[model samples]
Target chain A: MPDYLAGIDIGSTMTKVVIMDNGIISSVMGPTGPEQRRLANKVMEEALRRVNLSFKEITYLVATGYGRINVPFADKQITEITCHAKGAAHFFAEARTIIDIGGQDSKAIKIQDGRPIDFVMNDKCAAGTGRYLEVTADALGIPIEKMGPTALGAKNPAQISNICTVFAEQEVVARLAEGVPLDDLVAGILESLASRISRMVNRLKVEKELVITGGGAKNVGLVTALSEKLGCTARVPPEPLLTGAVGAALLGKDMVGKALKQGLPLEKKERSLREISLY
Target chain B: MAEEQKKEERKKRKTATEAASKIGGMVKAAIGGTVRAKEEGKKLAYSFIVCSYDEIIRAMDIVPVWTENYAGICGAKRDAQRFLERAESLGFSRSLCTYALCGLGFDQWREELGEMPPDAPWGGQARPDMMLSSGQILCDPRNKWYQAAQQFMPDVPIYDVGLPWPMYEDDIEVSEIQDYYIAYIVAELRGLVKFLEEQTGRNMDYDRLSDLVDLGEKTWNLIWETYELRRSVPTPMGTGDAMNTMVPMVFMLGTQEGYDFFAELNRELKEKIAKGEGVVPDEKYRLLWGGGLPSWFALTDFNYFNSKGAVFPVETTYRMIEPTYRLNIPDTDDPIERLAWRWLGYWTYWFDKAKKRPGSEPDVERLIQYIEDYQIDGVVMHEAFSCRTWHLGLIWQLNQLKKIYKPIPVLVLGAGDKKSLEHRELPSLILESDIVDISSYSEVDTRARIDAFIETLESTKKSKADQQ
Candidate 1:
């Protein structure tokens, strides 16, 4: 009989779902494919199954991120920018600035006491997004997940001058042909990406205590270089990618509380999660 | 029956754009005016939008065709891709301004085929007798778009006139260099006149040119006053409509039709205000589009905003007749000197004010003024990726505004039992897209940003009311 809330963030690269019920929070993450409805259902099913809950028991559902509109059962849709700020605020009570580098876009959200006051995003170019790092890592023959720790051991990092991901990959190949150390090249790529992010973050008049969320925050090398360039120690979420889903859950919980106060339930449809196949 | 039909029509939605578009249609229909002039044994000159050379061109009895205008027509019609690909095929990078790319491509294709491309937009831009180019600071494409294009029409001559202005800065006294700048511009104008006179085989008419300059100055005042009327509560017109109406302001300035068009527009706006009509019914939020040229392909987004109860009372982009009346003209009888001074006036209007006010930028100052006058709830800007002239200073301007201005007064908690006060900054949103490249734009992302901004504005509004 507990009131539950569901927050689903269907991003360009990943689909994440967070379920909150009886003061317990759990999440499931998976790759997003062309079939957004299937991805949304699969993640939601996994998250709910972990919590031993039914879709009917969820009081409110909020969707966010670029592919948010594809979530058919979402009661309300909010932007990832606002959700990221709320999600960061959940961890750091005084977190004023959020640097969220996602699959294709990065956002710098300014939070004032848990509410997003302003946000700046780099959606026009792929230079500073996770895509930049992904392509560069492919050229370096390094696993995307292991790029951080491997990059940390560089004695002298090669300087990457190109911000364009394609040109940066070309530079990586050229460096490899020149017999440049892989660790140094990776370190240079991370450093260059971090400096690019630092410039975008500074535009929002970044204030401390800053929190870095999204998949890119997992890279320890990037986190370290960002700290050095931004002049602040950055805080990373335990599951950086789930921050958006977590934020959506928080907003969804708030919507549930409001709907309960007004004695008006939100609009949502009951559907069989089993019907959706990842294929 | 007639009255009932009229009432039904009144209830139906109609755009104020028709009035401005009428003038634009006439102008576009005159596109092949250069070709017609050739048939009539008349001379034609190709020029850029910012040249302001129409007065001299008209005085010299030369037909003037704007390359930028032609480029814009192709953009609005969504016919630019063909010309863009042609330019790219000719080794011109797509990173260049689409306006320039489209023109260069069309010129090359026309010269190759010896005629207009199959079903070109606006019957294709007319080939020119001579090209008139300008060197304005900020737009590198304006300086280079024609030079690269001239390779196709090797016989046609180009008169490149330098009309550069000092880039905006904080410490430099613009007046210290104003005299030299004006003198240089005057000399350049004279040099242009010499070129035109040589091409047309006619003597320069100073009296007629002076009359044209006087007319342009009058139109400048009228356009400024006409847009100023939008500051009224429930503004009568929106910036999307202004984008259409500004054709005369861009092309027909220094002419009687342009002055009349604005005069009639001002009167219409005053009547709409008297009747208490707004750009949209239920105008919930008044937004100020502060800077950057709009994405031509996605102009319908204005209607989208309108559907969301957002009314754009003013935009700082195309309607840039901010402060023309306040310029200090030098003591000279020469119309070209006055033209030089007027050009400086438009650019330095806010700089002079910023000089008087500590910690102010021309662009940011204009933003603040428009925000207050228009009763704006939020500021939004489009950052076109290709052009740095309009896009580069945007982030700096936003940061400067946040640094200096605290417009929102909200209640706050103090150390003691008594409540203290705090001031918050207005929210600024920057939406990034290319001016002509449809590929760069994502409607879902843009709308999400807009929705988030509206939510932020809603919160800011609720808190502002809470203080009472």
Candidate 2:
């Protein structure tokens, strides 16, 4: 039997699970619907199946993300801030900053040695997150997955002054009525997003060896614009969306190691993973 | 959803209800105060919080109605949206301060109806005879809210007091600059006196004003002494109670009633501490409610921390008032001059202290002082989006504190052996919410964040104890 460490990230819009068995990693992702409990269990089962393991075989598991507390089977729960730091450190050990643009919020996390030194998150607004791209893509009649590549081909991007999604929608509609091309509008929206990300990054005054994670990292156009805006190369992990989940597993591993080294009595049942901490 | 959390929230609601009951009486009396003033043909003047004009108004026989307090009433009752929407309907932006919007809307509606609006919170806020607005460097809303309200009642005159201060600098002579700064603000307070005398057909009585000023000064000292008593282990009161008890300090500052309340409060707190009674049992972690205005609707969240065995020993919020004793007042026969010195003194209390310490910023220095004095293990702050004066510098302050402050020991596990060290800055949690807008707050998210932070404190405690 192989010992395993698992992490489930139940984000606002998506859920991703990652499990590691002796350095062999497997992960899965899906849309997070109205039911967080169901989503969390489904992602965990799917990730476990991919790793050729049963739930009981996993030695440690940590749950994280926005709906972190809702995961019933999670042995522990941690904040995405610390998890992202751990994941970014796994990707680039020297990563000084991590810029994560999730479905609902954007954050700039200052990282040092797989730990968060300082962080600042966008106040509750849909202005500079993945939702902005989804909304703009829908309004432009472009697929959400295709908004990135399409934005890269723009020759003249239409300017959008509104940082708010509602106002930005009005601006796009007005531009469309004035005969502005769709591609330019898309490019402009992505550019505006890049600017917002740069502002949060600048707030921490840390620009060296940056990593972009979450669903935003998959967007080539955003990556390009963000790199230029940041004036440095931004690295995306092998699996950008799995960073948070991977970070969760890393913490689980550390928790198990620490617990064992302390000579603490471990749970006897094969079905129990042994609780360390819930948060 | 756990039974513990529900029971904790229930315990919180009990205290919240008590606070609410007290607020209801205050609001009703203050509103009825307006009605009575109208019946008696007395003048009513509107003002903002911390403007330090309550004593002056009281001495001049003018009724002081605080607009910000009314906005908070609407918030605590969850009845602010109607007035907020009305303000927005009048071409005011929703992005503007909710308190200002609520006040402007309530003012416009009351003036239009020639009475309080239907089902107004606590019989609605009173219409002012004149308005005293502060254009302080702190809050832009203070400068604008009354000005906008005055537009609704054109006959009502407005006096704007610009209480500006020098933001701390390394390259300037602060004391000499402060001397000039104090003079300008003194002139402004005197101008308010002149304006009030004209608004009410009455002459200024200097002696009575001095007495009132003395009462106000004593109240500040009393509140400070009362607040300081919380430094005891298992603090007798958390910032939640402070938010309620501060009603007098903010609104009734110059009154003997305010002084009496503090006297009773200090006596009760001392008794509680002597008896070893605290906000909670088995208090594990002491936290500093560091900065920013609290979410009026969700103040009970403070009690949620209490449920987790975390007691707030100190807060650098609106309640951690500038001690009246710290102000250097020049020998002056005029109480008005002393009032000016007191106003500047409160605003600049941390500046001199901050400048004296190495690598110390004002706000961070205060946090350090508080953490030491209060035996604080962590810091918690509310990031109220609506107010820039208190909210903007918060992140920077936390960042600086983390950079400069050294970690204090919790407890060593093995006294004679190599112990585990929980080395680093004190953990800080920033909860984001609006001061008045309930919609901006999510109980689930906030509760989860706080729960996690408490766990962090617990882990730090355990780590320190487990050191070998």
Candidate 3:
């Protein structure tokens, strides 16, 4: 039987889990509010039930993301920077730069020689990340998932000038009052969000073969705007949000192999990454 | 009498001219030596020194230093750019503080060269042997840079004096801080003295120590005077230049040389004021700066106000809280408490003693007292990223200040590292506004957003006066 590995990412807004069997991602799932560690186990259990797998089947478990330290069952924790780089490299192979925009923060990671050599993170505020989009969506009374397509319909997008999400919402409302077209306002919001992410990437010199991931990667409008701003195309994975968890699981597998080769006991218990869910 | 007055004016002008000339000459000489040393295939160590006050590092015997002084230097500017590039190449993320990258770049440059020149400020090497820091600023880059320095120079010692974060004035926290402050001072002083003794094969004499302490006291007095002058109408110093004034004093602290310089400055500033020559000509509103130093990229916003006759009287938590630590004297048996008291007074590491009461917090009270004593008109709060401690009670403090002192306009600017400034509209709006309606507070997001708010304030004041 092939050994299975698990990866879990506990984000501020969402929690993601990816299970890999023999180096192939078998399944992935995400739930909101996995931020609390105690609650993560329950969510992970539900995810496992959906995939018809038990925690005992997994040989190794690795945790990544902001809440990595909070995950009690993980064998080891790797920085999101390293995990994102490894995951991006796995998918794109030639990707030298990885831009991950999660719910609360955004990060720009530069990869060299298949390793994350440098990374910059913006966790201090909710300006440029998915939070900004959420706020704008709430102001427009539009579902966030529909923003990308709606924004694409914009012809003459109005500009968003605020960096703070709270402030940007007010600005969006004010613009709406000024009778700006809904599509134009949406386009402006996307452009502004892209500009913020680009600044982080630009600091790293925005090297070629960029890979964009995280929940924000689902926004096609953001991808297009960021690509145009960066003057380079960014490759988006099929399930970008699961990349961190997938990378963590892969790392866990590597760790298990190294430990077994050194004649050491697996020591850590097998815990299901799917036990954690947002809802 | 007229001739005597004219002669005195000439002498003052000459002194001012001489001071400017001396600074220029030092720059020229340092650049010349740097160029010559570079050509000689000599390597130099690039050291980054981060502290709220410059005195401790200035007192150290190291030489060939590049500080904020090189920001405008001819080739120095290019050197900083190249240094930044090399730092990015070294896998340091650009999202980090520019100052850290600059320091790393300088270090890389020295590595590219072979050995340092004999007269290189850092003992004939371009690489720093030590990184001296204080916890006053609470900038993550300072801590991270020190760690990076440790990685590069595994053998070099990195010494840091913890400046209290959450500096709330209270008996318990203050007493505990006094202990930490005194212990840190004595420990750092003893370590440095011992190092110097080993290096020079002579112990630091009591006379020299006393003299150094006395000089520090004198510099402190001058700094107080400078702050006082900033309060005067048509304030005697512009905020742009005021920020730089602390640089020389900090870098030169704990030395007779620094003492002499400050003494000269004190004399010059006194005479200038006596003659009614204001530091900031046509000063209007006098604002207080709360939190870390304004970003270098935003120094223009500060200058713009100075040019428009607005004065930033007392800036930086260090200038406000450091003098309180003087009570932590060397002669006392309870030096540790004294040190702790000093540490407790620090802006970053201050622990609030009165957490139960929202408005009646003792730390908040003490801060209010400091602001009141300074007689500030308004407060400019920079809510910087990664500096969570500073931002926690800022809104509360603003509210308290308004309740006590009749609604002074509080402008809060949200700022982050270099990349954070890309969203500049929010800060610009705040700066331009007179009364920041909390509802409108988040509109301007960029670092430059404060400028807009300041402009709005000026316009509103003008309009109000026009109505009057």
Most accurate candidate by lDDT: 1
Q: Model 1, stretches more than 4 Å misplaced? A: A136-143, A158-162, A167-185, A258-279, B1-17, B20-24, B32-35, B164-183, B204-207, B322-324, B328-334, B406-424
The lDDT-based order of candidates, best leading, equals 1, 2, 3
Report the C-alpha lDDT of model 1 over B145-264, residue by residue, as the tens digit: 778887999889989888866776778888787888888888889999999888978999999999998888888888888898899888888887887777878777777878888888
Error of 3 at B267 (Å): 2.7
When only the first chain is scored, the TM-scores of the models are 0.93, 0.91, 0.91
- TM-score against truth, every candidate: 0.88, 0.86, 0.49
For candidate 1, give the lDDT of residue A84: 88
For A1-279, candidate 3 gives per-residue lDDT tens digits of 778888878777777877788655455455556345447666567657767888777777777776665466677766676677778888888999899999988888777544564455565578888989888999999999999999899999899998888889999999999999999999999999998888867756678898899989999989999999999998998799988887778777767887889898775844444434323
Candidate 2 regions off by >4 Å?
A35-39, A139-143, A147-158, A166-186, A265-279, B1-28, B164-183, B282-286, B307-310, B357-364, B376-383, B395-399, B406-429, B445-468
Q: Residue B127 in candidate 1 has what lDDT?
A: 80
Per-candidate clash tally = 0, 3, 70
Docking outcome class, model 2? incorrect
Q: How high is the CA lDDT of each candidate model? A: 0.81, 0.80, 0.59
